[model samples]
Target: MSIKLYDLAGIDDRRFSSNCWRTRFALLHKGLPHITVPKLFTSIHKISGDNHRTLPIITDGKTTISDSWAIVNYLEAAYPHKPSLFDKQDSLKSYSEFLQHWSLKAISFPLLQIIIKDIYDRLDPIDKPYFRATREKRFGKTLEDIVKNSEDNVEQFRSGLNPLRVSLKHRNFLSGKKPLYPDYIIAAALMWPRSMSPKQILHEDDTLNTWFKTMLSLYEGIGSKQPKEWVGI
Candidate 1:
């Protein structure tokens, strides 16, 4: 049986959850057969009836896993015969964890100020109230207020990627020459903004922009399936 990925969705079936994207890429990377079951923000509990507050949950037979990191480990262990998401080196796994947290803090969090409103605007009507309520409580501010002057912070967001930019200066991907779980972690972070907003978060001439294009073309152009709006190349 194919794994069931209960992925988060938005208005018009947009799958914008970065955590879910990480699992999607990991599944694709391992050549695993799975199907996505889109869940609205307010309907994630319907997936497992466990009061699940988050998504990117996968059910592989009797095994149900939540959170992208745990799901990756589950996939790695359960399907050891498939392509490896990580090397045997323990340090690589630690580094992948670092990238995951870094992307969340540096990339995804900053992006919320810019794209949170867009995300709210794109939600299904049934999900809007819950989204607004939960997010307002999380940020302790109204979405409009959080997004106010968001444009002014775009440069700041871009500047925060300096460490990543320097790291990529010497390699084609974060995982040396080939894409790996670490690559998926950062790619998924960018994918969140790509799906939520119609704005280009990266500078036109940045190498990250070029690298992202390559990512869009990978795995039979999976990332390109989403409509893109970049500054320029």
Candidate 2:
């Protein structure tokens, strides 16, 4: 049976969740056949009952898994014959895990502040209030306030990538030669902004931009198929 992926979506079927994108890229990298079910912020609970309260939940046969890292591990163990997400090495797996957290802290968090309003604008009307309320409560600030003067954050967001930029200077991917789970982690972070906001996150000369373009062309253009409005690239 094909795996069922409950992927988060915004207005016009936009799959913008970086966490979900991690799972999507993993599934593609492993050559696993799967289908995506678009989920609104308010409808995530309906996908996996109350057991899992997140997007990127996957159901394979009788097994159901949530969380991107958990799902990636499950896919690796369940389908050993398929291409490995961690290059069949424990060290790589650990590195991928570290990259996951780093991307969340260094990439996703800052990007969210810059693009939060854009995200809210793209949500379905039904999801807008819920998104606003939950996010405002989480940050202790209204969406408008959170995004206020967000443009100033652009440089901070760019500087955060200096480590990634340096890493890419040595190799085409975070995983080296061939892309791996770690590569997906960062790519998904950038995809969050690419899928919705027109804000220009990467400057023209940034090496990370080149890496991202290569990522978009991978897996037979899977990433390219998404609607993108990244502005000045």
Candidate 3:
């Protein structure tokens, strides 16, 4: 049976959230057949009624799982033949899970705000006001305020990367040679950064740049093309 993965289609594009892309990539990497349900931010109300949350929900005919991490976990268990995302060893698996959670909660939010601000700014003038208003209603703050707050976290967030850098030096993947849950977590968290980060930051380290290129190449192979309409300065 094919899994039904519901993603915010346009939002899942590189211009949007990396979390969305991670889930999509996981599906592709596992060679799992799934249906893509493209959701729009404007349709949050409808999605909430069905998902009881928001975007990136997945259903396996019998069960519905929301949240990107949860969807990934469900997939790993439901389809374990491809490879295990968590390690077979107990200690490393635990550490990998910890890193994944930390990356998503501590790192992804601020990064997402920074990335989305750029995309938000490029919306058609006629559409901008409504988009901003809806986001404010949903998030309880204007986009500018969110971006400003996110900026405050940048230095501290960068500081927190030392451990990750160390870990990356030792292993090609966050958990091992093959992509794992934490690998997806870090990749998703970096999605926005990869697209909108300053050239200096991107080129600061050869290893990091190579990793980013690898991710982009992987996505490209799976029909994860970004739409031209969404591209903006």
Candidate 4:
């Protein structure tokens, strides 16, 4: 079945959020035919309704799934012949899947907030005001308010890193040697920091950096037709 994914494009390369990227990566990983539809964060709520959810939402021909985790679950069940995203019989896979779900949620949101603000700072003055105003109107809060909220949850965001670090250390991939749903999920969140994080942080651990580069290479392989303009890399 053909799937459609909705997301926002043309922000900074850093804002290439992991949630959206994960869904995209999963679709590609399964070798599923899919179409990408870019929408601003405001448009996502407008299209999907008051949940105020953001990109990327996936629509299979028969059903529409929001939330990256839900979409991944649906895809795995729908395409069982593909690589198993979840080893239903394995307790470790189940635990890893559970932790991966929360990790994507906890880490990506706050980190994106920080990254978005950094993007805002780099915009030209006129563009900055417009971007801030647009975000405020869409989110029902001033940009400062949003950033403040994210700052309050910084520790929760940091906690996401530990599980990922452990997962990376334990296996070549987050779940195993081959990329699974969690690998794509975590990689999507990490893509932002991987590209924009200080060289010092990215290079701190040789293993982590090597793993990150492998993920990037995988994304490029799958998203070969991804518009050059859309891909910040």
Q: Which ten contiguous residues of candidate 1 have the minimum total lDDT?
A: 224-233
| TM-score: the better of candidates 1 and 3 | 1
State the C-alpha lDDT per candidate: 0.86, 0.90, 0.62, 0.63
Lowest lDDT 10-residue stretch of candidate 2: 224-233
Better of 1 and 3 by lDDT: 1
Top candidate on TM-score is 2
- Error (Å) of candidate 1 at residue 42 is 0.7
Model 2 Cα displacement at 128 (Å)?
A: 0.3
> Where is model 4 more than 4 Å wrong at Cα?
12-15, 46-52, 87-93, 101-106, 109-113, 121-163, 194-201, 219-233
User: In candidate 3, what are the lDDT values of residues 1-233, reduced to their tens digit?
Assistant: 88876665343343445667677777877778887766556554475485455667777777877777677678777877876666445676677568767776767765556555665654445445767887778778777777676555665666666676777787776666777666766766665554444312333454554554465556454422454321221
Quote the lDDT for 169 in model 1.
Answer: 98
Best candidate, lDDT-wise? 2
Which residue runs of candidate 3 sit more than 4 Å off their true CA positions? 10-15, 47-50, 90-93, 122-131, 134-141, 145-157, 195-201, 204-206, 223-233
The candidate, 2 or 4, that scores higher on lDDT is 2
Give TM-scores for every candidate, taking all chains together and pairing residue i with residue i: 0.96, 0.97, 0.74, 0.69
Please, what are the lDDT tens digits per residue for candidate 2 over residues 41-112?
788888767998888899999999999999998999999999999999999999999989888889888988
Q: What is the lDDT of residue 165 in candidate 3?
A: 71
Ranking by TM-score: 2, 1, 3, 4
TM-score of model number 1: 0.96
